[model samples]
Target: MGLLVGLVLTVIGFFLSVLAFVLWIWMLIDCLKNEPSVGNDKIIWALVIIFLNGIGALIYYLVRRPERIKQTGQ
Candidate 1:
């Protein structure tokens, strides 16, 4: 029925939200610990993740992370 469908949707939404949060936290930690602290790279990424939330985290993961890992071998 309608109520059952709503409950299912709600559960899926909740899991998605939790996944996003976990991703954000993981990215933030990775940036802090592994990112080069040579200049402001670590600080900048931290700010981006904090201010932009999940989107910023995803950006860091998809864009910068691979480059950093490849470039630095870290």
Candidate 2:
């Protein structure tokens, strides 16, 4: 039972670490993207994601950046 619990916890821990890594990579990618001439919002979001990690990425991707990019057509 203890071994099983440890294995489950280990898997959970691994997934969490992977999640953090993915968020950082996504932020780095966002940072590298060229900003649209019409807007600074995506660039701002990229910085926010870089600073705030997962939560920032979530908000930037879900709330702010999509509309901005759509408006820019880039």
Candidate 3:
């Protein structure tokens, strides 16, 4: 029972890690393509996503992305 529970937890952890990585990559690409390059917004957001990984991606998703989409009408 103990071994089975440990295995299940490990598998869950692995899948969650993969999901976080995918989210990070998706956010990075979204920033690169959609973020305006007028000033340093693109570069900054890209750096944030790269350096901060999952947390940064989540921040962007919850904050900037919606605002950007609303502003750009895309």
lDDT of each model, Cα atoms only? 0.96, 0.72, 0.93
Give candidate 1's whole-model lDDT.
Answer: 0.96
What are the clashing pairs of model 3? none
In order, what is each prediction's RMSD in angstroms? 0.6, 2.5, 0.7
Model 3, 13-65: lDDT tens digits are 99999999999999999999999888999899998988999999999989999
Q: What TM-score would every model get versus the actual structure? A: 0.97, 0.69, 0.96
> For model 1, what is the error of residue 37's alpha carbon versus the real structure, in angstroms, after optimal superposition?
0.5
Once all C-alphas are superposed, what RMSD does model 3 give against the true structure? 0.7
For model 3, what is the C-alpha lDDT against the true structure?
A: 0.93
Candidate 1 lDDT, tens digit per residue, 1-74? 99999999999999999999999999999999999989998999999999999999999999999999999998
On TM-score, the stronger of 1 and 3 is 1
Q: For residues 2-69, what per-residue lDDT tens digits would candidate 2 score against the true structure?
A: 99999999999999989977977775576457445357755676778878888777776686566756
- Arrange candidates, best lDDT first: 1, 3, 2
The TM-score that candidate 2 achieves is 0.69
> Taking the candidates one at a time, how many backbone clashes does each contain?
0, 0, 0
TM-score, candidate 3, is: 0.96
Which window of 10 residues has the lowest lDDT sum in candidate 1? 33-42
